[model samples]
Target: MTSTLLSAIPRELDVGTRRSAAIAQFISTARQLIGDPSQASREDLEAVARHLETLGRQATLFPEEDFPVDQEHPAVVYRLSEEADGGFALYLSAALPGKSVLPHDHTTWAIISGVQGVERNVFYRRDKTADPARDALTPERTVDVGLGNSVILGPDDVHTIELQGHQTGLHLHFYGRGLDHMPARVVFESRAGGSYRTFGPPAGIRHARITPQDLKAALADGQEIALLDVRDAGVYARSHLLFAVSAPRWRLPLDIDRLVPRRNTRIVVIDGDESQAHDGAHQLIRLGWTNVSVLAGGTEAWAAAGLEVFSGTNVPSKAFGEVIEHEKQTPWITSEELERLVRQGDNIAVVDSRTPEEFAAFSLPFAHSVPGAELVYRIAEIAPDPETLVVVNCAGRTRSIVGAQTLIDAGIPNRVVSLRNGTMDWLLTGRTLAHGRQTPLPEPSAGHLAGARAQADAVAHRAGVRRIDAATLQRWQESARQQQRTLYLFDIRTRAEYEAGHLEGWRWAPGGQLVQATDEYAATRGARIVLADWDGVRALTTGAWLAQLGWDVSVHAPATHGPGAARVTGPEPVRVLVPDSPAPLIAPAQAAALQQSGAAVLIDIDSRAAYEKRHPAGARFVAPGRLSEFIPTLPAQASVVLISADGILAHSVASGLLRSAKPAQPLLALRGGTRGWIAAELPTDSGGDGVVTGDDDQSYSPYLQKDLALRNAGFVEYLEWELGLVAQLEREGHTGIALID
Candidate 1:
């Protein structure tokens, strides 16, 4: 691997004076340290030990001794100095543990070099219900790696490093001039446990000499930038922007979660004083946030820049407000019940109906994005099971609440509920979020036509229809071919037309665009749709697409239409009645109650976490993959099992295990998942470490590459940043290699 090791330590710093004879002295003493690093003398290692000991505070790690003592974990660390490069910059860092982190971005490009040892980087999505960063601004994202050879970092990237192999290490983190202005950090999250956090400009990072008037041109450029007010709430209440989120320098954490959750967006912090905004941005940069430039003069500068301001009074209603109110509130699945469904592999569709931008910003890690406005427009992209439950959400109450009700109002066959209080409530409760946007989805869940599909059973099914090698699917296709049926198979989703692999002879008539282009694919307006998708969303969207095209259609589940859409006009509802069996599916809650009295045994059909997260406290982690082995271990006295998991496959596996041993224990499928239990606020814990061994699950990455990417808009600045990071990683002893890209 190509490495960009720290190549220079100049004799004279850019300050036009020799801050110290350190670099020259280092050149003279380099051989002793590198040749026999284990035998380096105290005097020779003085410079290296100074930073760790003092840390700008005459107390810590080595406070009792002449040098810093070995510390397993500590607080903030000063990473780099401006003298290291010509352009204004510095580096700082902190240690993270306990899996308590949120994926986020930085304020500018930084040189993050590892020290002492290697660390593992894990990215996560912000779970709104658990975005600790809203209060503490945690960083989270889906996993992404640029280079494998270096323990170095670059601009706009956020990650958490756990000292790998040796258990502990250090990092010489670096930040460019622009990053010195952040005031706070923000993270986005969802109830399903996904998150995305962003570091924002602080009140301190603003250029002291620049003025608000200097930013007028950039703002006038139209959507090129944002002016964030970081004054106290009272000050902002007195006067602020129609576009701003009452962002006081002290409130950057709170406001960022509600306003800007993505690092790609450009924002400038403003306050009564420019220093606050500048420092705000500076702090944000140290946290790995980028894309911010503080207001030169705060509010005064905005006025000087000739920008418009508005007096208070546009805040939306909070719960019981006059502007908006909740209608009939629907109950959501509990964590236990959700777990039950997960194990059973029951059809379930969890949707984050926020804006796509918002969804990208943060949402449930396992859930798919179904932008609110796009709900009715994309129902067909969800699951095809008529019994599947669909949950929707927005940032807070309004959209999520409204979206859920809208689905019920439509004829969606599936149960639909809104994430309680949306992401805002999720964060308030201190739950964790996942950052899944980092990787492309193996299966598409939410799409435009998907919403429409939710309204009609046949249409919805067709919309999200996928042709597996199942006998039923093959039989259907064979029947169609023998009958000379012209099955109009439409892939009603956008994105790529089956990036993974699609069935042959499939036509792409994305539901979102089909509303306007149906005529091109309609072919006499009598074509029967054979919608397709990885998750059956295409079928639902197709029905909606047909409705918009004026054709009556059918869909999966029920929530497929609004007040007016399509009408089911073809076949009559077929009601097939079977003879009553000895026993039927049992409720997970009932099972839990029984277990409390030794009346039953709770069985988990998912990963240990899915069950142990909040299932019946005594539930068994009888995973589907380990059914044969687990079956022998179960107690014969337990007669009933509340089978639980994320989907139906596990349920089937559990049922098979029972069959192999003379079908003694009756199994009841959990309707939802662990969500059903947790919704009840039932007791739970971090038990049951799940093991995955299939090809679908990865065990390890042979080569874990830690890398950084800098926007080369200014090559010189980018190189400086790159070099700075090289030094930081080198100091920490990370095996970092660099590539320009």
Candidate 2:
């Protein structure tokens, strides 16, 4: 390897093809092993974290329009790419003056390391008793809490911090998978009925693109030095300099704290022909990208110099199947085991980290309703035996493991093992379930909160998990559509019920590979995913797992009412009411029906998607990363329309779609869509057929640069790099990175 001033470089060239990089094979093998977004082996994730650890060239920063903000210290951001499971992984931040946000939470766990300034953290929880809808933004005041002033957020704990507003704040954040992939990310809206209305599921999140302008130039008179491009393979191939090789953007995160090896290394970013590579050059110079000078025009100028180039290759990310072949540990414990452990006088403290109700109706023998928030302080009073094995169990493992790991990391002197297979495992073993509520240990203290926070480090622990309620499963059975949002319900329960009583469409997703395998259900970025664990809690947390991805999400919190245990929630299955009736189809029948229902969803069925591949008129792709958020703006009673595909696929995918979108009227397919009108032929024109239509504002992704020509490079440079980072800080927050200035 050639030496350079930029230090902390990763060892070895991580080489692998796109095909070889797949957990199994992206399509064929991953298809069999993968479940929903909610399930992926922790080991697989750890491995991904490791693979991502590899070093790459200093990534090129691009120039793009700023997010509109009235505040001088506007919290601005630019996003990069996302992680494998589904969380916003790459993005930078800038702070705002006053209040940063309305108290909210990111879908999954995250790491908010300070890349710039000092920040104050504030946390909020939904007032369970308040009407979800009547809960206006200013309706409730915030709980100002102190968590030791700092500008860092580790991977697991959720936090909201205020930027003192002195300078621009920058934070490097890490998420579950990729930013756009978050599940059940409904924008909170108040309905007249005083309930929160959810929107559509995330359809397609935008991918980043890098264009010539994104590159910064640090020219030294004539430029007789070396150039280093630290972007990803996709960006490199779309267009790059012949001499430039791929050094990933990961360099800053993994290596920088260490060293930059040499001096005099004139590192120049080859991020195409445009933007000044100064930010990267600035970063490197700070890290000693000595004599660093960005190529005059980046790779574009170089390539335009008729330099050689490379494309169609892939950089190695983490290996996916690390846990697929291994036996997965059940995320929870069985009732009988809890009984036996309690009965045997074992020093085991079984903490039930479920909601209060779940703890009440039916619980493991002697497990206490420790509830996730109360796990910390109640530990000693509940368990007392520090040396004893502290077993944490939820219906399944996602939360239990997280809860238990919480203990482990806090240095709690107990062996924390999630019940291998949880309650389902016990039942599968023919153990009659025991039910009873265990009293709370106490109100908990600061020590408990601290301990809980410590354990939160494992929050990023992506356990192989998935879930769905019986009602949700039944609903999927009815009016199932063709392709739009198909939910391949995988019943992890026994084959008998699956064969005998399981909802009609559900397929069996046994407990085994469901961990290592993540592509099974909800494989398409656009498809809604649902997992059913007849075993209850398993589905809720599993759904929580998916919800973390910001994809629309909800679990069947099934009613205690037996047999048909799962009730198909009717009415607005997934509602979307457009702010205004732009599309043609506000028919009297549709209008009257919409007005009558509790959840009338009004969307331009002809809005987004179907037309991307050249469709008739009336359907356009939902703006990337926004299918579900806007859905809530519509009337809840009506069906979210999909005028594309003539409406078939949308209806089919509705059930699964609702999994992420939450409750909504079943999707209503607009027959013939806009095409039907043009054909039966009504008047229609282009909403944009996947092409870069115009800068008239109506025809663009907010994240996309208005003038971007090269789609791939442009996205990376403008959207992800420029706009993404700004938006990110708004989500995870920024309190620390400001000092770097």
Candidate 3:
């Protein structure tokens, strides 16, 4: 019967010419057979699977290059429809070899048909004898899905997939309802003592994609949505859909908490490829985001649909900065004028409010690094003479505007102005940048300190910021713990100052940048926030903005612990406890001896760039995600030693390797990772030649390109991107954001 179905296809027809039509026909037939996919029966799904198999065989007729898999992400999903609510969904999926997915059950009935390479499907059955709350899965059967083969899984089915062979595998899948909208799906894991635990589904599933027309309608109707461009800043700077914020794919996980604190907010992710959008949607879903979707076909599709696109990074913030400048008429000085004043030995003080690293990279002449948060605290020392003019600058306008305005709000006696357009404008006007300077602020006098405190109190009062005592803060902390609410206690000070001495539970965030990039620090919209500093100036200045931003904010006036009390140096260490392993851990010296004996194979799991900069001699760089692909290539009998920047990542990777079905060799983690090796005076090597597997996790940014022309173009485009944000925000109806006067 299957042979008869295969013979029906035109023998001489070109695959490329007939592919889309064939897939469309299959979709049409599947819809007819399984109308109202949510109500599809087991037999109805199986028939659809069989039809998919017939169509899958024709996959060879199409060009393989068209369905390429992303190495980093490993899978590419070609969405065929946008129906996400109890509606049918068709997707073409392609994955590279050696990919192993964890066991999971689709909340809806699913059918898969293989087109290329081989896929090993392992099926599991739920053990009814186990407690209802604790799921137990027992492996039942394994099926090798080859070209023309098909498999149908009921809603309750559980399975894991392993891509076989050394080639990419392609498959066509149809689901009863979209997988992205099914948050009740289960991921089963084997626990100790023959038990199984079913991990809860992600926060929420997002719709797969949104058409440009639909998005336009939503905007026109004033719907609330966060259009996020999950591409590199350089790519985003080049061109992107209107109102789309630049949130790089790699950094999205880290930044999403702060960027989209309201979990229920509708988020639409845009990217050039379906894989990035699909992966981004899944990531947000895992993080418990309730409403998310990918922009169908990305910017190209939007452009094709005759929609406007823009370029740049942080456009909204930049546009708001411009608005503030225009409305408030913020004081400003041209770089050339400032340079002339400095040359004339004028009584002016220049302060760079950027991070220490950025200030060190480049700054105006005689500028001191007093990061935004430290501006109020150290301003007395920076411009002690009330007659001295104070000029603040950053890499661009936002920080400069905010910092200069902050000083003004505090009623600083000195004449203050922002360097208009900041360093970018300075460079455009042919001014030179001073590099690698470390000028520190002068010590503050008693009178200067007293004046700053008084100014801060006034500003905080006007902003309606509250002052909290230690007892009140403790009550809030206890409430947060009991209610599962977020409470952030931040020390608004310089990194050096915070490292020297800070309250035990408080994390350090520079006041200026914290306000500028609030999404990076606070992920909960209504969370209580407390700002602390040695003197009250920095805390009050930072707290005032937080209050205006709608945060439940308070300033801790008196120091909880005076300088050096409850102190800890450096950032907190990340510790992930894995199951105890029998493999022995070797110190740097011991590993060196083992390497000399030709028994040690070191795998460095740090970032590719970090590995190339310096890695222990003979260490091969491999990303943790691609460890499965690299494992088979390692020497069969060599003892493997995993090393990351720290031992935490190495321990996790080693644990994963131990859990694999076919463990090749004994795996161990370096006691302290590469840092320990360096501390032990071990030799290191540099360069990409040491990379054994592909480095797909790190993406190349055009802004960071070595080509001077490309770099300059990126900067120019970035400014244009920023300029259009305000208009886009207005058009998109983003009511959640506000620009304070």
Candidate 4:
């Protein structure tokens, strides 16, 4: 059977194709050993496990890009091979830090072996004193499984898996049968005092198939659906359903949780064909996402149905911006006109309607960073004279037009117009941009605050944005916690203001960036969005736009004196699971001493840019995620010390290193990282020569490309795409977006 399968495959093929061929051979051998997986003996299972581990050691066949770790779900499982009868199933599991699975029984024999990083496996034993029905279990033993390690389990063996710290883990698992066929698997919810609750028989996974026409109908009826294109980001950006979000299959585990927080939200995945979509749907189900479906024929079917597919990121928001421009005839001036006005010394206040960072990077001369929602709230302060001409600009069309119209709609007395095509056009027309300008719009004066508030309130109400009190917000938060629905709470203020003071539980999403990248802020299509701000104008204005974008949005302002009214200070905290035992920390002086005396090998795990800026002399640079690869290269007795920009990353790296295959030795993280060393006035080297590992950790957007011509072309292509969105949307028969009367 293996020979026959191999003969069907082409002799010359890609690594993935070759890997598939090898998988077929491995499965054939496994079948010969196990005979019938359900009746396989202990020796048979052990033999099969050994073969699987040997196959797993061929890490070159499994690229890390095929398994991305994002902010969504911490782990993803890729099906490597499975028998026709669903026996002898094999999977590649890639897990990022902070992943924890409850004690669970596979109901079949299984073997797990590591290819990279560390995975802690804790075996559990059912308590003899407890009733079988109680499902009570206690930890029996724990093992740190990494490279050159494997754990085998019987059909009824129960175990929990955890990945701690910052590194990602790549492991191979061989199971008696595929997960889709395992309807009787048991998950033990262990509690205090050895008590446990059984999740009972697994809910049978199902992926509903929806045709392109039906999906269009659902959207036309304004049904809440997250149409996700599960293709690669680059591919998805080229062409995708207008409303579909780019939730790549590889990134689904890392991004799906945040992109579509509600597991039960209607999620439809699409790829080139139904193959990837079906796989993505199954993975989503395994990750506890209840409502998932596959597009019947994926993007090809949609295009075949005569529905126009869009080319760009944030299609919905960008299209809506175009639609608004078309409907409202938002006034605009070309780059030439703006330059002429500037040269004539006209009474104009150029407001960059983008984030402060973007405005500071490259903005028109004399332009102040007023940002998106702030255009309405602070226009009164920016262009105090009603006769002043206010020109709004963003990187390109969307925010420029939207921000300009926002001011006009808010009844600002000034004459407002957008800089056509924004900075992109300004550059294209041979005009220069000013860099590092720090003029941000200030708060509205006491005299104009009331008027701005009233205008914003009227606009929000007109757009059907609801105003919720603190009590209602609390109820919604509780309901969201209970998983009854998905709710997103955003403080629509500038980061500076948000960090200075914000509601404790709310996340800081600056109003402009939130609008610019709505998918990033909220992935659940039907999820409720609640905006917070000290004053009502910013939240209301932001909510008004959100409502226009077909979101169920509400604005809230907590009472001045109340239990939940106190504002917290500092940046929002990130949540990640730390190791059971803390990473050992050595103070900067001690670490320096150790390094100077050749007792410790100092490794800098900060970003390439940070490492090149100023790292401790003689320190070696390696990307944190690739630390495991570097660990084995050192001498067996080499004392390792990790350093990052801050001590936090060093601690995480150190914790993950302890679980690697390195020999037992004292491994310590530099306390306070490089910051502490620099603060202590330690000697430092400033160059990239110490970097042993190349920089490829981050993906750059088209606009951020280093190639000058490519960047310019990207800007042009992007602007053109945005301009064409409204036309495409018009051509489509069904759309959820609707402008308010």
Candidate 5:
């Protein structure tokens, strides 16, 4: 009866599945034997090693086709299986002949068993007699592991591997914990008092490559995709795909997790060539990003494919504004025409659809600061008489068109028009803009608020935006967590009101900027978005644009005086990931004291322009990316105190510095950064004396450019680019832009 039952089951299980089953059995037996690998004894290690030897003897399970090595990569590592919490991770590695690995210490216990060709493992120990300040290793023993051999290592064990045979080598590697989380793992460059560095997160994945044409097709398709330009901000600002988000390779660790929240979301990294994209793709994979790909030829290929590349940020929003004008045939008044109206003293109200800060910097004549989202809410009050003409303008054209059309869409009883090309056109016509003016929008009357809410709800509903109650929102949040789906909650109110009081976990995103810079706020391409406000008007209006932008957007209005009214105050803090071994933080007073005694040197890693503007009296400016080289040049006994606008960047820079080496000089990060120093009444020097590096770290906006000719030319280029977007969209493909008339 037992033979008949066994014969009934299929005998042709694939080699991969069989190997996985064997690994699971080994892991289960080992867990039963030693529950916590971190505390495993010598006997536990030997027992695991014997189990690995048995796994090694299963020749058919370690199929040659499963692992391949090439010239570009002498060795390739493949993840087999891992615990949900990243414990008991297993991998299969294949290496070609002449491949050698540097001596490294795995931060956790590990075991390796050979399945194919011979591998020479050289063991080493720290030399007790060597100077403690330097790294020194002494040879301990050697082992040649082959088809039936295995090696076991403790947490602190140091070893080097070399493929000695002409044949390709295949082996099984089991670790106490996954390599992804081992930020503290270290590797030595040489055996005798050489420098050492921590092993950074793995950055190699055999990712699929997509051409520029493939990217175009993907964008045209309805599915969400994040096209990330992995170049530096300054370089990316020069030229990039219109829909591409700037996510520099250096900042991926700090930004990617937040930007692309869904692990399975499709993402394509773009660079000048494919080099940075390849590296960025691997890093994304290491961070558990599964559906990542590299643009085969990057941005250069896009340009080569006869596709137009855009300069400046928020290209998608800017382009969409042009489309709105073309499709809606929205009324427009040129700078010349508007000037004539002002001269004639017509009953007109010019409202700037830009932030109050922007209005304060420069604006047209007789314009009031009524930012985009506020346009609908405050328009009735701004133009009391039904016959009054309302004109909206922005720094460029997007906000102008979007703002004016918003009122038009809401059925406001007034002649609505956008200032053609906005303030850039005004400037190009050689007109001086009003500066140092602060015009805030007044609160609308209660009657006007009710009307505004009704209009906004109508517009949002027309745009296909869904509405949800607070209870529904809570349920959706829970469902997102359970499904590992990406969800973003934004308070689409003015920055000041948002900071004064907002939903506890919701992030503050000014309504207009949210539409203009969607990529900046939520990095995930296809995440669910929920916008909230005190009244439903602003959130609904913003939701309209987002829905048209292909977002699964919903609007929520919290009760003003009820159980749902609880809110948190203060700005949200920026989140960053620092290196494993962070530098010690020094308080402002302590740092000042050290500086006063000439025992410490301050390094400001802020932008060169900012460093030149204001910095500690003796602080020297250095880019964070160049800190490693700059550290070795400092005085041997001097404590290096790093500072930024706030202490966050200083801590980040310090962490990176510590990760690479044990500096002879004492390394420190300012506890409160430069802000703390100033609050403590410390002396500061202004101007370029302290700027030791080039001004390349931060990109400059056209408004901030010092060269008038260049600035004016950039404005023209930008306006022209916006005007040409509709034609390009028609020629190339759609970006899920469908306007609701």
Candidate 6:
């Protein structure tokens, strides 16, 4: 019976299934041997290691073909399980040849069992007489770990492994606590009689893995789980798991707060590649996520397991909008009907509820840009007459729904409706869009202000939004600092309003955009957020949505006098203190002369895209991150002049180069940088030469690409992506978004 169970499965069955089954057995056995890693005895850990070695020896358990070593990312980690409190983690690691790991302590009990090839493990012992502040590691012994060979390390064990042989190697590692969770680990170097340094572990952890079936079961059981797809927008628009929110891998750390909000929420991340999913899960864990996991095989495994996948960005939010529209039978007007109404001189006001840039690019005739969150604030100004009809629109349906509903919820007396499907639908119906029309909302009258204030106050009360005076807000700010919590003061009004006059110390974040992309503005989950506006309407409306989103939000009304009084002027001048360096500063003309004379090589330290746009003639682009590697590539005798968009980056780069051993040449920073050169009317060029040191930091949108076919395809895919979001939301279960009647 055991032989039958261990027999090789058919080739048709995915390798993920077999690997998952083996990992499940290992998890079960480990749990039985050591119920809780933190409380487990040394003997218990050793017994668990022995069982793992037996499993490793079974060819059926860990087929070599299933665990291929990647050459690019040599260490591929497959997490099997982790204790709830992060006390322990089990994983399968594949290491390719030419890998050499420096000597380091795990800081916790760890076990390793080899399944393929060979690895040389060197053990190290700390010197008793060494200073406590520094690390002094002495080599003790070596062990050859081949197939079925196992090594068990106590909490204080230190070792290093090198895969010097010609073949790739695979091993299973179990840690008392995941490496990422370990606050500090010591690394040793044998340079100049050896020195040691303490550094944080790698960014990610070997987070728990879940099978598609398990995820499906969890959803069926109504578990509150956040399924995130960590892929680029283009890929996410192509296909993703149902109800999965699009939080690209690169933006996960920045955007996680808005998507999940609560660190304790159960999260399952998926990507096209297992490595990316694992890395993303680790990043989340590193950011204080307590319950995070990765899908074993990503979307492929989920599909293979007969689960549905979806497509698009903001799938849940878009879908929720659709549900609200359908259930409430939200009022909407077709493009043709709206055009007819305009032609007939109907008493209607059209408002574009998108970004100002988007509205400026193209908009409907007679439309003014009043973004979603500002709709309630500026509606009275746009349509003072209670009988006037109001129409809201965006590039698509979501913002339109939100904008129209916001006004409706605020008890605005004007008849309101969303432009069905927004601009895309208008274009499909052969309506020509007007470009560069800057129609501004009229100044509010006394009646308009009074009505808007009353409506906004009502909505805020309904959303349970608290309104604090300046004194109370200051108290909260001071309390937050004392408690080690974050407090964000955002001026939620139009950019024009913010720039013309605003309160000191309040950073400008427009109300509509803030609600749309809360993650971009506030990173700290559960942080206190205070919204401020000249008029009470904008702040209250924006505060309502933030409060609903689970933020500890409040609206602050500026005082008539004192520190909270609004400032009526442009932004305060910023004073930056640059570090004094011995390196010389060259003027634009002097640098130009040096370049022409071939005495100095210009290296731009700004973003690759910015550098490519415009830079001093003969300038080579080098990203700041690749400065060390790029310095060695430069001619040792050539005087290097570093410049950035501004002088800040230039000064910083020059300072670092002066300290480095390489570049054996005189390094200088341009006095003002590329902006100064441009201001001085110096010769500039736009294009990259043969020199490139690192990856470009900016990613261009597929829809914005020059290729007509690609752009058109992206648009088509985007529309389909948006269309499917409503269905996906219904499948996932209703998200707790309130649509006011």
Instruction: Please tell me which predicted candidate would have the highest TM-score against the true structure.
Output: 5
lDDT of each structure?
A: 0.41, 0.39, 0.69, 0.75, 0.78, 0.69
Give the number of colliding residue pairs in candidate 5: 2
Q: Which ten residues in a row have the lowest lDDT in candidate 6?
A: 572-581
Q: Which residue pairs in candidate 6 have backbone atoms (N, alpha carbon, C) closer than 3 angstroms, thus clashing?
A: 240-310, 319-726
Model 4 Cα lDDT, one tens digit per residue, 665-716? 6788899999999999998998878887654332234445557788788788
**Tens-digit per-residue lDDT, 522-611, candidate 2:** 222223446653433334333333434323333333345666554342221222212111222334245335535634432332233234
Over 636-731, each residue of candidate 1 has an lDDT whose tens digit, in order, gives: 666556454442433433343442234445555554545566565555555554332221111111111112122122223322332243233333
Query: In model 4, which runs have C-alpha deviations exceeding 4 angstroms?
Result: 1-209, 220-223, 230-232, 248-254, 274-279, 576-710
Residue range 143-225, candidate 3, lDDT tens digits: 88878788888888888888999988877777876654565776755421133444542322223456788777654443234
The superposed Cα distance between candidate 3 and the true structure at residue 391, in angstroms, equals 1.8
RMSD of each: 27.1, 28.2, 15.1, 16.1, 7.4, 12.3
lDDT of 5 by residue, 116-183 (tens): 88888899986544555457788899999888789888888889989986999988888888776588
The superposed Cα distance between candidate 3 and the true structure at residue 597, in angstroms, equals 9.9
Worst 10 residues of 3 by lDDT: 573-582
Misplaced by over 4 Å in model 3 are: 1-323, 425-431, 548-550, 558-613, 616-643, 650-671, 685-711
Backbone clashes per model, in order? 187, 130, 6, 4, 2, 2
Model 1: lDDT of residue 590: 68
Best by lDDT: 5
Report the lDDT of model 2 for residue 419: 63
Error of 6 at 663 (Å): 12
TM-score of each: 0.23, 0.25, 0.58, 0.61, 0.76, 0.58
Q: What is the lDDT of candidate 5?
A: 0.78
